[model samples]
Target: MYSFLENSTDIHIHCCPHINKRSTDIFEVIKFAEKNKMYAIGLMDNFSNTSGYASLVKKNFPNLNLKIFGGLIMEPPAGGVSYENAKISLEYSYFENDGAKFISFPTHHTRYIAIQEKRKLDYIQACFYVPDSGPTNETTKILELIANKNVVLNTGHLSPKETLTLVKAAKSLGVKKILVPSNNFNKTTIEKLKIHNVYFEFSYFFVSKATEVPLTHIDDESHKIKGLTLKTLKDLIEAADPKNVILSSDCGVSILPKPHLGFYQFIKQVHELGFTIEEIDYMIKTNSKRLFRI
Candidate 1:
């Protein structure tokens, strides 16, 4: 057992398994969480409402000792990036236990796909567009819904410029919590996110060789940290500074180690790289709870 995580209120996991062809299912993830005594675990299924599954697990497995939350990924499968679809997903699980607490921008259908596929400057799906100028009437509708619902919004795979625009719009809409899934931003962008009071997530799985995650280059050396080396990620984290930074295991793929194990390894590696346990705890534990309010 990883004693460090036992009943640890400082460790929160963002992408726990059993969804999207992952190695483990909701039930298995719950067992893992219970065994490890995690603080909280987030369930995110691309284009589907998996919070109900998390709700069911919590209902049936009353003895499981961990907090499990769920969210919706706004993609084609979940009816694209439309306000109506986003509302439906929000209402679908909003009444269950803690409700669906998260709503992500397009993930698989963002500019990340264009970069990953080496395609022209186009999104994976043209349903929604977050222009460099800012949110449009259609985009504002979704942002307003997110603000009204008080759900955490993730900047899913959008380019830095687009993400900054979206963040500004979200801030204008009075969004409580805004999370960026990557650390790939320039110092200016990082400062901007901080100014907007957004949470910047640094995922260990992205840089893990076992996961083979794809990365896009940015102007800063820190933005190029993804998929480079763990030390580079460590450097990026240090450079990012603390405050709203968060540490999460975007681990679910079969090729990588299990989420809990991989996260433990990440913490250990970072500690060895010079970060103190208190600093790591703040990212995994404090910032997570603060973001999700769990």
Candidate 2:
């Protein structure tokens, strides 16, 4: 029988100095995972490629028994969804092993963030621009590239309409895995995502009342917005199949619970709300392992 900690693999962890002022560094994150006996952690550095760094760190710390994965967020910092950039990142691995396990679309620099925060239109740079017909030609090309690479695609802060279009196109192009950030998902699109086998992720960072990552570090105005309620999460879980659901700590802010504790609490709360252990395991562990291909 696997221990409780053995099952939880955190797919979202914001480390330091990547747009968001994260409390933990790559090394600290690994230490925490080792101490808690976690299987893996995905270093979600905003607008940066942390995959190579994470692989190097793991090599340096040969004694630690944790898998660290990293990827590029197709935001401005990552050269904004260019095919060449994506190819370089996707090919980056330890020797022949694929270290770049996940690839997310724009996060802070999305049109959705601009509208939500009332930022200037020029402030946000999107991975793909959509017109009345559908995603632009460039967007389609990028989707094809992503599909061929077969990396996990995270819908980072894209509006519901954009997410729907992107998911539909990505699936048709052969992108096997998709992940939608927690609050970004709504009832209208749940069933559609299920049809495509896209995974909807739930995180504790936004919901935790206690601010951990210090408001000073979070430059994005959306972080100031209130997080979704546990009830909302429950509804989302019930609405989707257990296999297509993923639970993670989008945790790393100094003000919130550490990754392990936040993840544990997320499970505890959902369980208290009547989510079965099997269901929780599938979301928190099984789905993430499959997504990260660990």
Candidate 3:
């Protein structure tokens, strides 16, 4: 285990029992976190609620030292963005007297991106979206639930306009904890969003080319794949300011290394890029703790 990882937490990690292929299972991820003396890890699935699975793990592993949490992705498979689905997920996530810790808007199944990429999935009607006027009554109701529960809100794969609108609404609703993937928007948008105090999640997966997961439609030639190099990542962190950022592996695809190993390499590279240990820890450790309130 790397010294920098001591007491760290990764708020975004993909693991098995997923609709798509993954490199590791929940058990493998847990063992790796415990082995590295990590404080916590949040499990994310694009198509379902991982809160029930996380609850089961906690119930079965009573003596485990590390905290394991899970969240829901508001996509078609999870019942889309609705108050009912979020309520049910939270109810089902109960473990150790707490419910699900986070709730994300749609990622791959977002209406904006799905239409943009010309995806042919049958559940396109169920894809999540907010009107140009902003969140609808139902969406605002769900945001209220998220705020009342104090769960982290993740801006998943929405366009810059949609993300900004949603973030502004979530903040107004008293949703204190929010996370946005840094790669989803440009530096100017990121800097604009900084005023809301949302945590920017930086992942090494953006730089890694190996993945069995389909990031784009087969016929979408207009969409070219791009990734951030180490220097770009450094610039993004500096742009967002280290205090409001969190580092995640976003690993677990069949071809990528397991989350822990990939994360080790991520921090190592960030260190080599002239980020001080204190800065790295602030992003990977302190920000995570504050966001999740662990």
Residue ranges of candidate 1 with Cα displaced over 4 Å: 8-21, 94-97, 120-128, 211-226
CA lDDT of each prediction against the hidden true structure: 0.68, 0.74, 0.81
lDDT per residue as tens, model 3, 2-83: 5966798987788847644678899999998999898898888866788888888988999988898888888766777888
Query: Which of the numbered candidates is closest to the native, going by highest TM-score?
Result: 3
lDDT (Cα, tens digit) per residue for candidate 2, span 154-215:
87777777788888888878888788885657676787777778888877776687432325
Q: By lDDT, is 2 or 3 better?
A: 3
lDDT top scorer: 3
Residue pairs in collision within model 1: 10-285, 18-24, 18-25
Per-model TM-score versus the true fold: 0.85, 0.90, 0.91
Which residue pairs overlap in candidate 2's backbone?
A: 211-255, 212-254, 212-255, 212-256, 213-253, 213-254, 213-255
Q: Lowest summed-lDDT stretch of 10 residues in model 2?
A: 210-219
Candidate 3 Cα outliers beyond 4 Å, as residue runs: 94-97, 120-126, 211-226
For candidate 2, what is the lDDT? 0.74
Q: State the lDDT of candidate 1 residue by residue for 120-212, as single tens digits.
A: 453444544587678878779988988988888888877777888899889888888898866455566676667777878877666677435
Ranking by lDDT: 3, 2, 1
